[model samples]
Target: MSEASIKRAALYRMVTPEHICPFGLKSRDLLRREGYAVEDHRLRSRAETDAFMAEQQVKTTPQTFIAGERVGGYDDLRRHFGKPVPDPKATSYQPVVAVFGMALAMALAGSWASLGDVLTLRTAEWFVAFSMCILALLKLQDLESFSNMFLGYDLLAQRWVRYAYLYPFGEGLAGVLMAAGALTWISAPVAACIGTIGAISVINAVYVERRALKCACVGGGSKVPLGFVSLTENVMMVAMAGWMAFRTWA
Candidate 1:
């Protein structure tokens, strides 16, 4: 296509000897994907970048201009094209949903492989066990961070801080034992102990106190809110423990 037929955008970004702005590359890629020819302008030093920002009255770099109209920074450029911009502080269940979805898939696959069936009582048990394992794995990734987050809402963790750290290992162990349908004597008590504490904590924090907080059930890094989903995790654990005990003894 000719120059006149092409959509054109001018992007100004910081590209110093020490650093290159990542968002600038993102902006350039977006423009090209949207069929725009980008005029890439590098503010080679901090002085030049500051001057540009001052002139544009903008706070950040990776600014884009289209049709002689300044579209601000990378996020602003996305908005200019009517694209949805991601919010950092947005409450999202995507991570939790993904973990649960994967756990369910694993359960179904395991059932088919072992029993030649996708749906069964064992599959449901395995699904919950797998979910616990995954969730515990997420927590164990950064135990310190998870503990810190858990201490915010957990009653037992607040009183005895070490419980927060040990919680992941206990949950993971319970999950493994439950999945194998072995040593329910050990797994049942572990699951029940943690699950009761977790459920009560969630209810107190989210239901009774009505305080909105991040859930440590998935991980400290997760933005999953402290609410029904969080409660469900604990409830599932408690229910799993009871079911295992009943199956083994009654």
Candidate 2:
């Protein structure tokens, strides 16, 4: 074939209707990336395509032609070439676990009878109870999003936007509870109960997620692996609950 003929005879696949995206740019970028361009019109008539394939001793459907050689469809070629596999999701598990840890530590502190006058059970109580409550409230937003997912809707279409607002809310309440609990021993039990409930919620969420169910903890920058965070939170709740029970009975 003449160089001019070869230059104009570019390889292209007729785009099936399914090949389009929601934005209607079906595989254009992908085709461009694969050393081919999308033509607005089919390059060859069906009979001509079949004739070419018969002459080349190749199958006709979605074939590739390069330098007088039938290269086959790029998909099949890629399979032969072995494409790199990408990670399914960018797993994350930081802030959620940290919150649970902080709450549990505070709960543990409340159970320490020998903490002395500077910091008494009352102080621990307020911090634990209030912090846990704040966590529950913050998590409720995630729960709302998760529930919506079952109906084919995505919660928090963008990442970390929700957290920008919620982090302050959590910190504010946590600060108040920490201050109040530190001043009075009476607030300690309440804090422990709050913490216990929060932790249990985390655990339950994780369980549901593990069962291929919806997730309700998709909060700010929370794209990480949440199953572990959920488990840890649940254990922390149990620990806090046990500590509160022990203190109450003692």
Candidate 3:
């Protein structure tokens, strides 16, 4: 379409001495970006803002109207522009990603500081240990939530609820021992038992039963999905345990 035929938008927002609506500015900018000629209607006082809302039957300021039709508020403008609106209640892998990313970074830093190399056997061990510590910390943050989520798939936890609560402590203890390269007898067995149980539980829930669920790996509060990442964590623990046990015995 030609520039002359571009859509027109009307915006009503608060611009009082004490407050200026940020959404109003964003709406105006978005409208301009989308090739809309905006008619900015500023309400200079609370009374005027209230009056405008009442007249327009809107509960909020920063209302936008496009092509003589009410386009609602800032969120509405985004929808009209075909933007992806964020859902506050939605599940995401961000928490798990962030935790794992940080764990890897810490591992690299520790490796550089101790061994003068970024990639080594020690580095890989540190990565696994650090990841365990971090994941355990997340679970410990809200033990109740973690236990509840864990019980959904963990066979041991389902049979013995206390196991869910004790799991984090066990993970954290094993991680700390492994990270320091101390108490191999204790840490190795702890890691192996938990890892084996976790792997089995996850396989049953995800593959055998085909049950879809949330992961408690990051934390009870996280929305991370139960799948490959969770399985990888268990596998890492099992591998670490095996490595540590072999080193101790050999």
Identify the leading candidate in terms of lDDT.
1
What's the ranking of the predictions by TM-score, best on top?
1, 3, 2
lDDT of 2 by residue, 46-98 (tens): 56556666765766445544454544654544443465433446564555566
TM-score, each model? 0.86, 0.32, 0.74
lDDT of 3 at 102: 91
lDDT of 2: 0.45
Ranking by lDDT: 1, 3, 2
Q: Could you give candidate 1's per-residue lDDT for residues 1-250 as a string of tens digits?
A: 7867988999999999998999999999999999998899999999999999999898899899999998888888788789999899998889889989999999999999999999999899999999999999999999989998999999999999999999999999999999999999999999999999999999999989999899998898878899888899999999999999999999
lDDT of 3 by residue, 140-212 (tens): 9999999999999999999999999999999999999999999999999999999999999999999999998
lDDT of each: 0.94, 0.45, 0.92
Evaluated at residue 139, the lDDT of candidate 1 is: 95
Error of 3 at 90 (Å): 5.0
Q: By summed lDDT, which 10 consecutive residues of candidate 1 come out lowest?
A: 71-80
- Which one wins on TM-score? 1
Over 4 Å off, model 2: 1-89, 97-131, 141-143, 146-221
